[model samples]
Target: MDTDEQQAYRQLALSGATPMEIAQVAHLHGLGAIEIIRLLRSIFTLEFIEAKELATQAVYGMSLSDYQEKYLLPLFQEFEREGATAQDELLQSGDDRHL
Candidate 1:
């Protein structure tokens, strides 16, 4: 993905946009559904890893398992659910545009 596009996605996520909204904006910018999903996953994974690293380096360091259980797991699950919804929405929108 282009750095500018990735940054735009990150900004949208930070601003609390839903996955469908992010996907819509990405589509408008010429990204297909797969590219949008890949970009979103990449952004989310990078942020998750960064947060884990920070937590590990803190004075009160959190163990990997504890961090995963308390934070990563739940967030990942939520992401999966949102991602599926976004994919469906993107596909439907694409069909509508073609028709």
Candidate 2:
């Protein structure tokens, strides 16, 4: 999305418009059908993720970053380390098709 499109989308979203409503408004704002769909999907996905994070923070009584640092960051780091190890093994074995 360009600057104008981004501003319009942000304005519409902040005004509490739903994805479909945003798409409609964006279409009327001269965005193409594909562009509207892509923009709406991107915005919806971001909003959904943010909402989930907020819910987690509310439930845990901690900031999202704090909660993630305490609970999720280690697991993610471990997964990354394991993934790297697995990739290294695959490369060493010359079986890197998956990689």
Q: Best-fitting candidate, measured by lDDT?
A: 2
Question: Each candidate: how many clashes?
Answer: 0, 0
Q: Estimate each model's TM-score.
A: 0.42, 0.43
Q: Which stretches of candidate 1 lie over 4 Å from their true place?
A: 45-99
> What Cα-based lDDT does every candidate model obtain?
0.64, 0.69
- Model 2: per-residue Cα lDDT over 8-72, one tens digit each: 78788888987666665665676665566567656667465454444444345566688889989
> lDDT of candidate 2?
0.69
Alpha-carbon deviation at 6 in model 2, angstroms? 35
> What clash count does candidate 2 reach?
0
Candidate 2, position 68, lDDT: 82
